[model samples]
Target: MPREHPLLPIVSLPFRRAGRDPMTCRYRCANSCAHPEPNASSTPYFGEILERSLSRRGVARAGALGLLVVGTAASTAGPAAAAPAAPPSGTTSTSGGRPGRPLPFEAVPPNTIDAVVTPPGYQHAVVVKWGDPILPGAPEWDLHRQTAEAQEQQFGYNNDYLAMLPLGTGGRRALLVGNHEYANPELMFPGYTGIPDAAQTAVMFASAGMFVVEIEQVERTGQWRLVRSGQRPYNRRITTTNTVFELTGPAAGSALLRTAADPAGRWVRGTQANCSGGVTPWGTVLSGEENFHFAFVGADEAPESMKPALRRYGFDTANRGGPSAELIDERFDLARHPHEANRFGWIVEVDPFDRASVPRKHTALGRFKHEGAATVISRGGHAVVYSGDDERFEYIYKFVSQGRMDRAKSRAARQRNMTLLASGTLYVAAFDATSAAEIDGSGTLPADGAFNGRGRWIPLASDTTSFVPGMTVAEVLVNTRLAADAVGATKMDRPEDIEPSPVTGKVYCALTNNSRRGADANPPADEVNPRNANRHGHIVEIAEDRGDHTATTFVWSVPVVCGDPQDPSTYFSGYDKSAVSPISCPDNLTFDSTGNLWIATDSAYALGGNDGLFAMPLAGPETGHVKQFLSVPVGAECCGPVISSDGRSCFVAVQHPGEITNSTVENPGSRWPDGDFGKPGIVVTWRPDGRRIGA
Candidate 1:
């Protein structure tokens, strides 16, 4: 038996507040849920595979015709996103089903807690909060007296997507890189109404970007703190207000990317709306620019030829009257600078070790509403990156660098490896389920006992080369979503952070909930996404062909269909339902040293509880056993989960606490960590005895 935790009670609220707060939907993602899905292409779902598979010879012949030839203008005519003809039909395999190690900690129960809840043996601390003074000579944070200059020197708001890279040996020091995804003006400004003034807007822009701070481990424990002492050279702030980022790759100097300010199109001012990211093997970081469509105005008045690409990227073209960043920067006004919108939405690379290093945006990675960039080394020594376009009925993407990684430790070698992402071939995913005939959109398991499938990576573009027939290299890179749609890629349900396990090369993606799944002509439920009106999303496991990261073909299966275990719709890799904890809305994903999957949740209140972090063994007897490791504060979503290389500390970014509708700084809904206001911050959790996490 477990003792009851003395915290906030589990209050029953209406289903409306269960998922995302209306205020969060507006501020975080520009009320994206309220708008129609940008991807309106007539792409076929997995159910079409059954109809095509009736004739093996015809299916094989069509599969070959479906794949677009890379490095050339070879292409397909219609909606035929089939697999390569060489692979066998319905070929799939499963892993991690045997007996293995058991989870040691007890699960935490769901609650509307105003504090961070952890398993009994584990402990947690607030590592750093938003608006803390990170740079030297920076004044303390005062919500009422905030200025853009002061905020530029302080830690920004809404810390998300955190990673701690080793600074030196012995784990005593490390560098922490995090993203300030977006700003919540209602929560930041006291007595705030709608549409902030120039000063307030400037402060908000200054608060949104990326941050790098030096952190030191405490006494060999998992606890770490920001270095507030002498000569912290690594403490730098890259905000949307002033940071200059360089443009790289084939699309860098294209006419579409050029603007009146530069004309050269070789440089950009800043990176905004950075979500989740991954630390690369070459000792740098790659952050994705997400939800950038909300930052611009005058798109309705843009050039006639540009309206299609703009609307396809979620731009509000019909509404010309709205307050946006155009007031601060003319580049945001698409009517005056239609080409400026093309500059953002690329993968940004930052070298944290060099203080004077100018960050670069790689154009080879197709531009979209990127969730994050996770990289792995392929069997053929190429750099493979996986990213998700986070929107309803969007597609997943991959990039394979043509250049091999330089393994030498010299600075010259590091500089050479930095250019790896600048030239790569971009591909999109298309799935074909084996059990398509049994999918009834009711979350029922097929006769094969699992939702498994076969899939392929459809090439879209390469460096200075166009695989898409009509689009040029620059057009394919800038208008990537359009090219993917042209190639008939599979539309997924808000694919978020995608990661490849360090222990196993298998890739895992969090297909976060899509309320519109099967609702009114949206893509119906298939094997991978096995639920209709999927409130609690599921996890996907993909094994590349021949264990090669750059392979075009792969096998996939849904290991966990997250929801209440009592619900017949939920599936947990054949685990005992009574033994697993309920999980909803899986978002960010990471892995432990032993290959256990650590999942961070966003908008998990759909299950009538606060969002939380969960751990599930990927293989063995406990493979599908889900355990709740920690629960965030009320009205908050968990993001940017990273485990230390030593396997002792786990870091999570708590974002947008106390963001309930109509709540302001004057009367906040939940006061967490500081007892005064709800501030988004990074937290570190570990065992008191300093044992390996989840040991």
Candidate 2:
């Protein structure tokens, strides 16, 4: 295949999308859980102080899966059965088998090491990694002499969320955008020096952001390499140290976002803590800035009235020890610059095709710890985006754009359509348990026997109106969780990644474990979050009324209560309890073209093993059959799993391998993919025979 002109670089264009509505397609909101989970693959973010307000805690151990859950049903039996992908529509058995003739592969047990473990017939490789040159004129990586200038042009650190959109609609070339959630200084720097000098801190600042690059498939093979043509035009990096982002929606110029530098509050210097994100039909990528407040300290000297809001956001003025960000950037000292914290936690949008375009933060979608955004078109053509606040006890939200998706691919048309998210109606979820009284604060089924419910998307604010009394439209968008609280949204068990099924039009959310369930250190178990002190979380499946993407009313049920099946508390779509792979702490989620749901786990609590990826059929005979496709290294959390357009290759971002107690660059626990210092990167796994991934 012949390649066209090299892709253009990311140019920064400025346009306020607030009123730009010309029937162009619009985008939606998304967020990622930037703050690392306890003893997670990375370091601290907002940390546990926020846990107080979050009012939550426990996860199942990674190993000892069966020991944790005792007396339920055995999942790993003596022999195994063939599990095949159920036909998109058919009458297949829940325990799928036989018709296709052979099973894909048996589920692999959890292991502790540093390798991209895959099925026998599959092959894998590292695509792009930290320190690799991505832009023109970038110097080769030199660990001993690292600098912000060099880090800016190289791949940013801690690759988390990623999106691969076809380049020019061609199958051979595609653009990949990955979110560098945050930098692991200990792992990056040679001697493991703490954040001390300005030079080193600048490196940290430059590494914590996002990077966009183009990739091409090898001649007639599944292997893809970074397009190495003259200065990759589309290759660029958006970092906390330099790139500028424009704020959109109701809160664009709000006083709360105004800083000494950006008094207009319409633009911020950069986006930090970007986590898992989504792709829009209009051809742009959406990234969620999560726990951006982690880098700052709360304002103790601010007006008393503003204290509660600051604390609610996990901001505290107390200096915990060691070199602090406040020493370098005053904006981190909330007492000196309080509003700077408000500028983050919004779903940010970027146009991958045009490097010159400015990234945008859609404030209409509210501010919170976002797990990221996923969108689906409504029956009426409206763009409906789904996002979950990654904090435990927070709520899941959806934004319905006023305008419909404009399939026109012209540059002008796409620009106009991108503003759809800038102005829309945002709603929070509220669940009504069918069996309200049966919940006895234990991880038990209600009188109705299942943790099922009827729920409604409570409208919190529209682009122009605020449903919450006393708050303005702008205020509602900025203080979304407060507005959600005021309107009685359901407090979930650490709502994480959520997505709508392309084939079924149903929405699924990963409620990462909230140790604070029944006696959750706070609220008791509700029908939606039924487990008491839920160690292993569950998957909540939502079906909008009449399959409408923007439907206000919906029905929901717990499809998979995760944990060791032997433990009496687990549930897996009521399928044979003995047949499912044990999974816990579901984080990022995505479905293949065939409609099979692929789940990436953040915490392997139940099995005491490395976190891994699981594939479950969402329709027909294999609806609840969960199979472990692959597992990451010893301490890495699997993230950003996206299937190539052809469905022949699946790429998963292995974040922070070798992250463990006492593990650092000098003393690595796992030097995976490359045996040296631990680095976060993406890995592509494909079948040797060119079959579909997970086949």
Candidate 3:
């Protein structure tokens, strides 16, 4: 029989040693529990576990659950039929799929320990890079001839998130917004040392980080290219020194947001370390501020009372000085700018359609180490956004707007739609399992057939109200973790990317590996995280009641437990273990037109292979046929696997190229898309015959 739920040990069953292979034991237990009539409280949880186990055994939940529920009904009605065959690979159809054409690339290149390269019949290009020009009369980039003033107007380094939105007319032009993540002085500056003053003032300026450039796109032969020169009217640059963003939502003008520069909390100087982001249906761009902890210092010396909130947010509780005190910018010294850290870690929204629009930082989303935000339009027309805090033991959050969506697709409607995100209610998830209470640290199946349960979205704050008893709405948004703590929200294992399955409207979250899971004396195993030392990670599926994205309660399950298929703890919706690609450290996620989920990996453990992108169907007979679509080279993470609206092209960002140890420009380990040296860049892949990608 399946084991007990992790959290409630009282419901657990004794684990048996079934030979050397754990997969066999897991499989056998699931198959044996095909038909179980547990109590009502445990039925739902058991059903989820059973479904997961059967899925790993290659049995569809509908078929397995139907058999369990109806029993001899099928036999009485008619003779049992053979199980349906799995769909042929590459047979799925997406929006751009058409007849009589081959796929973009037959398959991605084999796993590599180095940098990025595309399959044959595909080409990659660097649209823009650090120090590139974005505004009129901007000076060309000169690494050796650098100045902070010039760097302020030039493109920033380490572009993470990218969004391209169309401008007036039939897609002839567009605006591209790119986030400048943390600066890599060693990689960006020549002859760089820890010294504050470098040979290149421009490099120092670039290191502060900023958003730059709006390139005009020229419609080419069915593709788009950046126009080097033109009437570029909407082009603008937002840098670390001069750009001002307004505070909105719950934390706007709160005391926590106050700084020497903005005592009233109305404005902040600039955005920093922006990671991944989303584009709203209303044409605005949402950028997530991540890893803002390293930008400020001096928390260690602050009063003891402030330490709790700082520690929760990953800020230094011991020393307050940023990541590296000696090498960091002087501005990060908390003694110099006590409130600098508070200015970051927010979801900043920019109206790309309006050049003069001042971006607003929405506090309702609750600040932490934000990875990204993905929104799903609720059945009731409200927008529901899912976000993750990329720190171990952090929590996942969702925001549901009170305003309904305007179905009209007109420009005026789009303008109004952008405001939906600014006013919303934020919630954190808390999961509960129903099962035998005997399951302990071991990764075992629960008696209820699954490590599944129902969960509630505990509200933290709304437009003008706060659900947190003692804290104000501003406190709830600014120091969100404290608020979540008060409400006892369930902590998760590094929630990375939370996205909705376009086909089913069910949400999928990547709970990236957490070494701290099942730590000797910390937060122990829970239903959501069934494994003790969760090293390989898993995928969480949340289905809102009646398919309502704004629902307060929902059912959840772990569909895919990522690891080597040979490992018994790993599960893949019952697909043949040998037939699927081994995956780990799932981070960013996107969906193809055919409703297939594409997952991107960041850090790989077990030295299994290179980080890459994997695709699996969320519906149909081949729902769990996970396959490796692409891989990145050494020292790089596969990010931004966004398929085009037409499905004809797939774009991925190969970040931190040539990031291997003890390697420099003179002796780079991998010279990727460019032969001379490797530079992190965005790659586009399309069929040679111009057919839909992934066919």
Candidate 4:
């Protein structure tokens, strides 16, 4: 049975008091501390100042001067203006209804293939994978010759999120940020046991993590390959053992985050099991900490008072020894690092431009089984991020920062903007699906042919205020689940990836799969969920009130009910069911240049085929025109599914390629991307004719 933690605690941290005198340097000294004022002058490069600050105190003269100018300008600009009109909605259409001819290589085979395959006319290749030499002088991987020291320097495992940022002037070189969700010991170890074996455990531990590599585009082939030589300055790795993360935002350094390793509550040892992520307009990567519960053990022995938040985050409350404990750090042992579990579930930000940069865990976003974080510019120019806690009966959340974004992606501007997620307001969703009066346990369309309704933002915390009334801001952000519950937020069906439509300003959330709704204690079906015991979930479209992401009210609708289209309970916005591909357990989502939504599936039920990537024209007559584009090997889930800005290339993460019950490396259930043995990896697909992907 799934564990249910109580809502997180809520406490408020007062903003720093204003300093006396206009010319006094109020900037504090700390590696992860916020600037006293947004306008305080700062050095040209934030990385340089941060490094200097880590070694000593005092602000750089140049930085202070720059801040002065910014502060002066901000003071004159006054408060931010209201949001502009939303962009017109795009047309939804069937896959066959598009005017352009379909690419011959748009779909691929359904097999447990050992190589990266694409449609007939498309090209596919590996961009990067676990243990690939990334940094300078990094030794090549030797499967049997693994070491924690070497693993910390090489690319990590289970690449889930992919983002390529162009480097230099011509865009030939780029930096790649990928998430290492978790390691499959059966595939990663030479000999493995579910039981804890120190040596075997070390190898598995080293492999379970995230990687940041640098690569350049091969001009002739339009393929991307790792830059194996040169400084490759941007290449780095964030693993489970050595990487250090700074805490920021509302819950930063709060009592809940205090641990023996970080009694100051300012830093964490590493980033574990990162999953789907998003890129900020400022050129930074925002990675979600997903499935973090599995990395720890002994939640059952934690102080009784701490169990609620643990249960809310999916930690086993009855058993102190969690799944595969012997393979993980003993700090996970509540007997040791009692507060360790509290450190794993926040959104982590990495600035790829600074190779020596420390990734930060932003606490204002709240903690849960985060799948992905998507950002959009609010009417106030503040950054608004949407996230989902991927669990049955979990909730969807959003964070709006106090600082505005820098529209232009300059180095200095990007540095300033990267701090946007540090301080903000966090909210959970509470919806009222009124369009469907008779939604009753069936996945049927409402009388209006939609599961649409109004909704509220249900504020959890804002800068220094805890909206739960009885809770404090720290408690709200640290133990946010509790605060969300206190306010009666609506429970969702395993909300997975929540992303905003860059073109529409509306947000889309994938409610993956839920088999608990309508259960004795669970909530009954509503228009939005529409079905009790939802198996294959649906897509939710939310239009923020007045198109302002910071608004507390909004309108929502279920645009797509996922399942075999032939199922009467399922509806595809009236599109032809026979023409659409069946999809289940929608896990990750991405949008193409044309605004079509691409969905990747995990755990396809009764589908009788490998999980695959699918695309649908979210707007036109083919709005429900879902088509399978590519499938992963048996037992593997298609994740990431990132389409480049130009739409020329699509990258997907083939996770746990050979995952299977009782499967071992010697007798793998599925060998993929490599014929000998399957190593989960990231695959890049591009059109041979040089046209945009999915065109």
How many collisions per candidate? 2, 42, 36, 42
Candidate 2, residue 669: lDDT: 55
The runs of at least 3 residues in candidate 3 whose Cα sits more than 4 Å from the true structure, single-residue gaps closed, are 1-110, 119-123, 168-173, 195-224, 320-331, 409-412, 434-450, 605-608
Q: Candidate 1 has which clashing residue pairs, if any?
A: 18-605, 98-620
Candidates ranked by TM-score, best first? 1, 2, 4, 3
Task: Give the better candidate number (1 or 4) by TM-score.
Answer: 1
TM-scores vs. true structure, each candidate: 0.92, 0.84, 0.80, 0.83
Best by lDDT: 1
Worst 10 residues of 3 by lDDT: 66-75
lDDT of 1 by residue, 577-645 (tens): 999988999999876655577889988778878888998877667778899999888788898887676
Better of 1 and 4 by lDDT: 1
For residue 674, model 2's alpha carbon misses the true position, in angstroms, by 1.5
Model 4 CA deviation exceeding 4 Å by range: 1-117, 322-330
What is the lDDT ranking, best to worst?
1, 2, 4, 3
How close to the true structure is residue 256 of candidate 2, measured as C-alpha lDDT? 82
Evaluated with TM-score, which candidate comes out highest? 1
lDDT of 2 by residue, 112-148 (tens): 5457787677777888888888898889988899998
State each model's CA lDDT, in order: 0.80, 0.69, 0.60, 0.66
Q: Model 1: C-alpha RMSD to truth?
A: 7.9
Shift in Å, residue 597, candidate 3: 0.6
Look at candidate 4 and tell me the lDDT of residue 392. Answer: 63
